[model samples]
Target: MKKCRSLCMLFFVSFSLWNCEPDHKKYNLETSALLALTSTTSVPPGSSFKLPDANQTICYDTSGVTRACIGTGEDGEFTNTPAPFLLQIQDSGETILEESSELTWQRCPFGMVWTGSTCIGSSLNVYWQVANAYCNSLTTAGRNWRLPTAREASLLADHSQNTFLPNTYFPNGQGAGGWTSTPAVGFFGRYLVSSGGNVTPIDETTNFPFRCVSGPKAPNASFTDIGDGTIEEANTGLLIKKCAYGQADDSSCTGSASPLNWQQALDYCNNLNFASRTDWRLPSIRESYFISEPSIGNSNLPISIFPNSSQAAISWTGTTYNSTLSTAHAQMVYQMYVYSKTDSANVRARCVAGP
Candidate 1:
């Protein structure tokens, strides 16, 4: 028994996921341990999940046409497939345990009931302000629920399909949209999961359906400027080059970046010897999230941290795009998308090192 507890502790610490006095139910120890072993990275299992998934199996070129993802150094070439998540459906399917994130979600939106097979009844579309109050009022499964943060809300998206939620995990669960707790930078209002799977700020008075989630706080990426041209993300031990490739780095990156094809981008990082370190490589799709605190808007990147990055920072990722539940995270407007590895139109490269 002691050995089992020790292993579980290691799993939680390795993934930085264990929460004290969790507001929801505890995870099944045996299952979590096995899941932790599924990771291919240095970190344990929970970190390998391909959150906010993408689905661009067919690569596109600068002219916006479909092609294959072979020699193009595109996302489809490098993205590692994530293993399946073990969903622990509980409370007679009213509650769902997303074991990978350790977040329990209400299967149906507000005003709907899980009728064993699917959610029945029309969902309530509430304003941004009411989202929190409504979620807080819930006593579902004896856990304190709240509106999910932007990051948490992103995790719910399955970009592999056009639908918001796959019917398998969430049957007939589609609503107009859902509200996130992230306040927009300006007065646009709160963020919402649009029908297209992107999170954009909408007017405060706008109504959108919402679901409740109960979990420990979501993991965030915090960075420290390394005096050199790189910043270290405290959470993932990833050191990121401040500027995208082709941009000169000094007191904030400047100069128009020279766009590289996907393959050349990969070569540039592998050959990079910047900051007296030669270990740099392109960031995987999941690793890209830990690079910098994402900007919900294009210009939100602080000049000190990511100067001159205000434009739609369409950058290349090491992860290849696949039309499965397991791939893609190219960032645009702080939202996730896929770029054809061969598309030289606008996508640039940002190199990273250390996990």
Candidate 2:
């Protein structure tokens, strides 16, 4: 029955089930099930998700270093020249509305109630189940609310540095980490920890701090094959290369995905010219994190969207936070990870264009 409703939604139709909202203050188990139990999505396709800048200002070299962003093609080099994540604080000041994704986020983390002036109270640490139960029952200005997915969870964190901090729009600081709805290997679910923590996959039964977000859920996988080796993602307006590094896009991306060091991977995308677009570059950490899949164990990315994918689908991002830390986003094997820039690790490169 849930599957049928999902298919109907894919064809531009949406379904509402058990919508006996006579009690707005209480959590409707049936209506809440539509968000938590059945599908990991709250909104249908065409609802956009925006990628905010990492807000990195200073550049870094391969070794112990601090530098400027004049020439280096790192994330710091393009710190909001044009495209930027626009967050609008609602009139109540308790909720925030992100312009690009159009999702309203609760200002406070779970367990901390919004007291108009600010969020007060200690954060509640509970299992994923408890977290969702709280989200369902709590009534804040009355909007459909649920736990954030991996992509939405990633956006709420402060990724400017390797450590976790308050989001620019978040008046109250975030907790250590939280449970995301996106499931990972086995019973483990994706935990959106600090930028350094890299969305660690852990047992979902464990207790952790979580935040609630209401409004449309970001699409799990929404892309249109542009027919010329590129697929344009409707949500972020990002054009990603269909093939991995070293694979030829001859209809089906053939051959093995090449493994290149961090520097080599950066160079590959920096100099890439395909589909008549020369603006291609190594994707930023946020951008790479955006192309995520919920079933991220064997391969989280949708096979129908990114077919013939490399078995080991780890790809480098241009996010170099400090001298030692950079990012590598994956669709098949690993989650978002931070690695030593000068390490001998060799990863693949999947380039992207647009903001």
Candidate 3:
């Protein structure tokens, strides 16, 4: 009985030892799962794996902490101050021409020659063709010069101050008349007029004084078709009506343009509503001149863009001469002239807006 009891105790001790042994398969699976979790997860605060945003540059601190450098200033610098860029042009002692228009004037007219600083107007007047050829052959400041266009010449006159070719820039006592590159519709080869800002047409064969201009030729006025029956002049930023008043078609004023008296024209323009705008009004003489395409000759207006433009000899302008309350100015663009007329006289109206 003692031996059997001892054997039973030994058997129970062996069973307990077997149960305490580790399972190698389960241990390997748990170890692999822990390694995967560590590999997929983000690195800790001081780890090298961390990165900055795509637009940012990485910056390092003295203490070995990584940081992002952002914004306009130099990387890692707090202040965002920027430096300004400037353009400077060298100046010569000669008169500085207008940069925007790139135009410079000779000190004297054609007949009177420019003798450096001043001019002598006693020279004989030359024919219009000779005047043009002389200007074309002129070489000033290494630039090929040419005769001034009608519009360019007109710009020299300050109508507001009633001044023609201010004496400060142009030599005084020189001939006040010059030939323009613009040609008249009915009369001669090219137009000639007095220097007093008047557009009196003179025959091309007649001798006249002329001024030389040096710069880029005046470009054809650009137009933007708004597709809403309105055209915008890119040069002057003026929006023009696609059709003239009393014209039946926008493509062409196949019918005669309706003529309204000065007051009626003003009222008609003020009441006009087209292209989703209602602030239309009669164009000023300057604005009217802006749309005039003297280079195109026909009607002295841009017929391709302004299809409904009237072929009429004269059109009413918003400008009024204070000399007489009853008279207002009209632009005879075909003839390249402006004249005062009775307010009651019927004239065509073309609406315009913006400066």
Against the true structure, whose TM-score is highest?
Answer: 2
Better of 2 and 3 by TM-score: 2
Which ten-residue region of model 1 has the weakest summed lDDT?
34-43
- In the range 1-355, model 2's lDDT, one tens digit per residue, is 4234323432321112213323223444453444445236646666654556756667666663667776566667777522465678884877887676677887777656556667666666666555665566546677777777767766654445544445555645555368777655454354555434356776555668877778777665577888998988765678889888888887778887887777777777878889998777777766766565555446756667677858246777777754244433333353676566654445678888774
Q: Could you give the candidate ranking by lDDT, starting with the highest?
A: 2, 1, 3
RMSD to native, candidate 1: 12.8
Cα deviation of 205 in candidate 1 (Å)? 0.7
> lDDT of each structure?
0.60, 0.63, 0.51
Ranking by TM-score: 2, 1, 3
Candidate 3 ranges beyond 4 A from true positions: 1-96, 113-124, 173-177, 183-188, 193-202, 248-255, 261-272, 302-304, 308-311, 320-329
> Which one wins by lDDT: 1 or 2?
2
Q: TM-scores for all candidates?
A: 0.66, 0.77, 0.61
Candidate 3 yields a Cα-based lDDT of: 0.51
Off by over 4 Å in 1: 1-86, 160-164, 173-177, 259-298, 309-312, 316-330, 333-347
Worst 10 residues of 2 by lDDT: 9-18
State, as a TM-score between 0 and 1, how close model 1 is to the true structure. Answer: 0.66
